[model samples]
Target: MLYVKIHELRKRKFKVAQIAKELKVSRPTVYKYLDMTFDEAKAYTEQPLGKKRKLDPYKDWILAWLEEYPHLSSAQIHDWLLERYPDLVVGGSTVRTYVKDIREVYQIEKKVMIRQYEAVPEQPMGKQLQVDWGETKQKTTDNKEIKLYFIAFVLAHSRQKYMEWQARPFTTRDAIRCHEHAFQFYGGRTEEIVYDQDHLIAVSENAGQLLLTTEFQHYVNEREFNVHLCRKADPESKGMIENVVKYIKGNFADSRVFSDIEDWNSRALQWLQRTGNHQVHQTTKKRPAEVFLLEKQHLQPVSSLLSYESTHNQSITRNVSKDNTIRYKSNRYSVPLGTYQTMSENLVWIEVKDEDQKTLVIRREAKGEVIAEHLVSSEKGKLIQNRHHTRDRSKGVEELKQRLVSCFEDQGQAAAYLDEISQRYPRYRRDQFAIIYKIIQQYPAFIDTVLTKCMAEKLYHANDFRDIAHHLHTLRDEPIEEGQPFYTSSPKHSHIKASTRSLLAYTSILGGRA
Candidate 1:
């Protein structure tokens, strides 16, 4: 009816609105159905005798072409067939499905079977978690080669998965830390965690008596989590997480470009909630997020004031250089001058992040006064002599002047040298000077002497401290009167006379008298 209206309107040169009114239909209806309603002139008439061509003759050639170019589409195959088999009577649409069927029959195409998975009857929510690592090649901004490992953890009952990347090489520490992070991420702990017999956490590969790394076992027991090793060569024991590993690699890692591991994980986690978690599980026919939300209620509550060492722990020992600087990474970090008076030796806990293996040392003060503390790395540098001070928005230079005064309060004459540095480098703020103060604290005994020497030599840059320290070492050990050195009477002379006057003097002074 719409086509008839359009045809009539076209014949009479009428507008579509007039045609729609005449046809008792909306203008859009008339326009939408116009093409379908309009009749097209036939190009040929039906004939009793028509030519028929069978494609069976070209079947061998088609099969050979398909074998050579397995990925070629049906239209491409049709064109190629038309070039040689002009008499072939196969439509492109039909040819495509035929080729697809042939590939399937030959097992050339990958087959995905959706098999039902039966949940273990004894397994309960918050009972078990599976852990695995996924790795892929990556390049950093500095063109450094790196392999990115995504640590994936999934709860058995909820199927709630957590994935994050490791910065450092995979080790026992990394595996244990991954579990700790996953527990904290989920906001609770699981009763048991399943694992593959990977060397990172697994100590030995005895089938029945699998031995987990001591460190890993300790972490689990401390957290009240049990360890369950999956059967070797059988991923089905922890099959849920194997599927998760594949999903994260394909859906998260493959679809994104990342400059850093954190950025990659952030995007992956965003997609995890936005896409993966919300989607219905293939076998369970239930959304994982919904199920996980329900399972979270069953999770064991974390105890208040739980005492545990950091998962990423490293030891820091106190050492004050003769020049009064705390040594770390062969570089010096400063503390207050009188800090040594409070304690002879101090143990510091350093949290080493696996992603970059970067260290963060915690500092605590007993009083309100600013004391010696280790400065954290802000950038890549061996020594940062200059202190870091935030810009004073209100008092401005006055605040800096006060900081300089504080440094002077700690070191009397050394204050003049710091004042000179502040005068020379306007950009050097109080915080930067505080770093110097920290250095002073670490090496209080020698800090004053070193500062005096540095100022006398007009050494301002922090990097110059290394050279000055080396020069000071030379001066301190300047070989007292060479040839007549302490060992001069050694060789057979000392054995010949045990009570010689020179030997007696040396023995009394050196406290080596027998």
Candidate 2:
């Protein structure tokens, strides 16, 4: 219409400036329309003015790189191009837009979509809770980027949700802890929980059957709750929790400042109580907290579920070392010596009852036999031993001490030495006594001498006793000349000859009288 008006005005001898002012268009637009025929102006309006892009020359390279590394971000691709072709200069946003277009054109496989399923109707109140994990990168107050992982649980009927965040990924133990807290927050637990095949809970799926992780399976059995695993890659199956994850990211996490994980979690709890659960849910149009009151009665009583103590019961398999010890939480706990007679053949299942106290109950995995129990040590690189596990070895040491004492008429000193050694090196008493026993066996005559030297030097170690024994043996074995007096006393030798002559004369006198 504007073009026709312009043509009619131009034929009427109207100035291009007047047409531009009347139409509120640029003078150049008016003049261009004035120059074109009516049909030509319409055709020109239909065609788009294609502008060339700076990245046009590198389209082929970008597309090829995307085809090879589809996961690379635009910034990463930009850096790669700059390195590959130093003369290339392109903005990151341009590469991002171009990469997106190339992906659409080539039909690149960005993500493999699983089979879709329709939404399932809501179950009875407290009948099911959908659980999932979501991760987001957050910047700390110090301007450091940290990844936060959240475990989200949403009631299927009430749409009530519970979430917890941590700076680290959730292990099986952490998952269980989060579940317990969620249940406690709701004042109860649902009869079943729906999961999206989380590796932390579900290990694998075969023929539509879910194989839960051992820890999760035990937890389910203990809590008396059923589990429903969603089909692989099927988020819609447990979409309630997925939405909760998104809602948290958009509403609570955006532009939030938290000092640390604990602070964030505390704030998150307050957010759930004050805003998240109290707000009218989009789908249900009812406050989740309000609906949860009705659902809470349907949920299993908090007291009926397993206690927090039972939920955290952890059974970890550990290889027993040759010294009858197993490492746990950076400390060593002793097991029975027979527990690992063959290398790599024995694995003990350490059931930790109290982590704070470092108390553990150990069992032989192969035979299901309870071998030993120990109070775990808090200090790292320290060994906590149970003397009962080495009772036989202790008995052998007792026998050696008795034999050494019997070798002396004055056994008081020897008994005192053994007692002192047992007290000084309580854990290694057997080893220390064994060294003493070796010294006694090698030089029975020098046993007292070695003990005296050990007491003088305060050497309670086994090697010290061995060294003293070697020195004593060397001294006792020194050669002596036949003419030299063994006692270095001439008066004692002359008295010894006179007594021998008197004894012979007395025997002759008695024979002659008979």
Q: Pick the candidate with the highest lDDT.
A: 2
Q: Write the residue-wise lDDT of candidate 2 on 1-514 in tens digits.
A: 6677778888888888987666555577677777878677667544311146677677778778878877777788789889989987777788877666555434444554357667577689878988899888888899877778999988999988899998766767778888888888888888888888777898788887778877688888878888888888777767788889999999999878657888999999999999889999988899999999899899887663555464454565677888889887678888876777763456677776765675688887623778888886667788888877774756677887798788865699878878888898898887787777777777788777666666766777778778767865786767534344322444645555443456667778888531
Candidate 2 positional error at 28, Å:
33
Q: For each candidate, what is the lDDT?
A: 0.61, 0.77
| Tens-digit lDDT track of model 1 for 174-263 | 666666666677878777778898867777767567677665667656778767888678787788899999998777766355587677
Best by TM-score: 2
Measured on C-alpha atoms, candidate 1 has an lDDT of 0.61
Judge candidate 2 at residue 409 and give its lDDT: 57
